[model samples]
Target chain A: MSGQTVANLMRGHIEALAARGERTDGRGANEFRDVSIETGLIGTAEGSARVTLGETTVMCGVKLLAGTPYPDSPGRGSMTTTAELACLASEQFEPGPPREPAIELARVVDRGIRESQMIDFEGLCIEHGEKVWVVFIDMHILDYGGNLFDCCTLAAASALAHAKIPNVQHGIADKDVDLPISCWPISCTFAKLGETIVLDPNHDEEMVMSARLTVAHDENGNLRAMQKGYNGAFTVDEIKTAVKTARTADKVLRKALKEATK
Target chain B: MAGGNSDIKFIKKGKRLDGRKPDELRKVRIEVGVLNRADGSCYLEWGNNKVYAGVFGPIECHPRHKQQQDRAIVQARYTMAPFSVNDRKRPGYDRRSSEISYIISQALERVVMVEQFPRAAIRVDMQVVEAHAGTRCAALTAASVALADAGIPMRDIIPSCAAGKVSDTVVLDLNKEEDNYGQADLPLAIVPSTGEVVLLQLDGHLTPDEFEQAFDMAYKGCMDIYEIQRAALADRYGGSA
Candidate 1:
């Protein structure tokens, strides 16, 4: 059979199974795959974490540089987020510029952290308008099982939580300080397969899912950011259900992040 | 930037900063077939440096004009994660990375049995997730294992390592400080079975005698790494240790 034909057959099979609240991997409609986070793995970077959600693995590193602040945000620090979907992670990801998916991924993750006010921007200021710490969050997709959004978010949050300001290295102080994390925003992603919404879609499910939604929430259960993806639409009730599910997922994921860093 | 820091003592009591002897290599661990999506993959950790290499294809070559009528071509890409270094590196292709990729592709082409898959291309992706020093050597070594894991036939696995002059002494497997402040650095990769050196690059300064000594040290380091590479492949294929 042709590649598309095989994909169509698989998609039909997956949707059929999903309609019964079942996943091909035997997961429930609201179940997540195993999530593991390891922090401080990269000694070269100020802070780093590797997060694996099921088989999809992403490594995030936080590097801080002292530079002139943007004119608009002279008193506040800045952040630049970028994601590399290298072909090494999967054959589907081609080499070249940051294509649509990668750009979207980075921006979505950045929105979660920024909107949540996770970092204390004022703490990063060295001198008002003159110099401030710029945090660089670089996410590397090492293995592409699926659910890159949640994996990248978890890795970035964990790495930032684990980061330390390079005070001594920058001659700003005698010792380094923590990156001044004010909150932990964990993201939960769901895929719409047939009429059922499943949490944490794997690569195979991702290939077949009609729509995807990622919702991020902070510790207080307040929604911080969200992104709806693909050409499929979600019902009003489905969006509400996703938000509720995100609350529970945030608790579990945030606990994992805390344990890994501690 | 491989020379000219005079203040700090790189050698103390004949021991390097990390306490390795002159010829001792940093601790290394290699695992094959680590990534699921690729045909073959390898993850390597040398000291604190971490790298992943994956091999795909003996498939059709793209952009028809690049095809070799007689044999497959090796397309190797070497990339460092932005956070792989102390300072963040801009993502995407830079001149340095392009050069490294070209050199690595040429080196792999020499070993891969390309004639078997005419007009095809073998893609090798080497990612330095975390780097200390000697990443090029680490990347080359990991790529060789990844190719083998892909079940690609080759004359031999290439073993790569570096030797350098720090504190006026030839040392094997230079670390970050050594590479930055040392007098010379010589990275070498060879086809272990034939001892044919396929890759060699140098920076800084070394006299003829020091150069020969560094080369010998690097060759020995490669031999040691070769054993580890063989063990990794065997471990993956369930062969005898």
Candidate 2:
């Protein structure tokens, strides 16, 4: 059978399940999969973490290098988040430079960390405008079971939380120190499947879902970043409910992040 | 001769740095079918080196012009992650990577039965996530296993290893420090069953006798690694081969 035919069949089956207030994997409408994280796996990187949300897996590595800070962010450390939808992760992904989906993934994950003010950017400065620490968060998708937005965000945040300034290695300081972090930001992603809103959509659900909504919240439950994806519309009531659901869901994610980093 | 670091003693008595004999290979670990999306995949960790290889296709070749009417083409890309080395490497393909990629493609082409699939392409992507030394050999070894896992028809698995001269002593598997100051380096890949050398590259200098010894050492190392590759494949299927 053609791929489209299989997708259509699965979509119909998923919609039927949704109509009954259930999910294909037997989870509740707002339930998320089990999340597990491992840290410090990449020895060459200053900090690294591998996060598994259900079957989806991502590896985030942070490299600290001394370079000129950006013109707008002079005296503050700069950061660039790059997401590679590695061909090994999914059949749909191709091998090459970052494409549209990969770019969007990076931007969305960046928005969460940057808007949350998770890192102490100014504290990373070694000199006023001459030199500063630049953090590069490279997110590699090892498996794309689905919901990369939340997985990438979680991986990036956890990696940043574990990062250390290799000051001594660069001969700038007498000792190495942890990267300054001020807050923890967690993101929740929901897929609109027919009339139902499912949390942490898997690969099958993603193929059939009409739209995706991702909301990031800081530890204090303040909204930091939000992105709506796909060519689909949602009612005001649905958006409002999504925000409320995101805030509540973040608590569980934050707990897992804390335990993983600890 | 490449300049050697006089302060560092690469070899003493019959043992080399890291306490290994001249002909000893590093500890190796291999796992196959590690990726869910790729047709085949392999992960390898040799000493401090880490590599991942993924294979795609026997599918249609892209760009129309690159396709062959009578056979498939094996395209290999060997890349090192930015943080794989002591100093951060910029992301993107450089001359070194392109050369290694070309050599790896040629090596695998000798073993894979590309003629079976006309007008198709088999892509092998080898990524070095961490590096100490001998990354090319590690990448090629991993790629071979990935090809086997992909179920691509092949005459044999290609196994690779490197031997180099450090401080006037020929040694198997040069590490980072040794490579930087070694007098000579030879990386070799072979079809173990056929005993045919599929890939060979050398730099620095060595006498004919020393070259022969280094080649012999690298061949032995490749043979040992080939056994590990077979064991990894056997382990994937849960039985002895």
Candidate lDDT (C-alpha), each: 0.90, 0.88
How many backbone collisions does model 1 have? 0
Candidate 1 per-residue lDDT over residues B173-229, each given as its tens digit: 999988888888899999988889999999988999999999999999999999999
- Worst 10 contiguous positions by lDDT, candidate 2 chain B: B1-10
Model 1 regions more than 4 Å off: A1-6, B6-9
The C-alpha stretches of model 2 lying farther than 4 A from their native spots are A1-9, B1-7
Clashing pairs in 2: none
Local accuracy of candidate 1 as per-residue lDDT tens digits, A1-262: 2223455678978898899888889988887889899899898799999899898989899999999999999999999999999878876777778999999999999999999999999988999989999999999998898899999999999999999999999899999989998888999999998888999998888887889999999899999999999999999999999999989866778889889878
| Per-residue accuracy of model 2 over B126-222 as CA lDDT, tens digit each | 8787898899999999999999999999999999999999878899999888888888889999998899999999998899999999999999999
Candidate with maximal TM-score: 1
RMSD of each: 1.9, 2.1
Worst 10 residues of 1 chain B by lDDT: B1-10
Model 1 earns a TM-score of: 0.95
Best by lDDT: 1
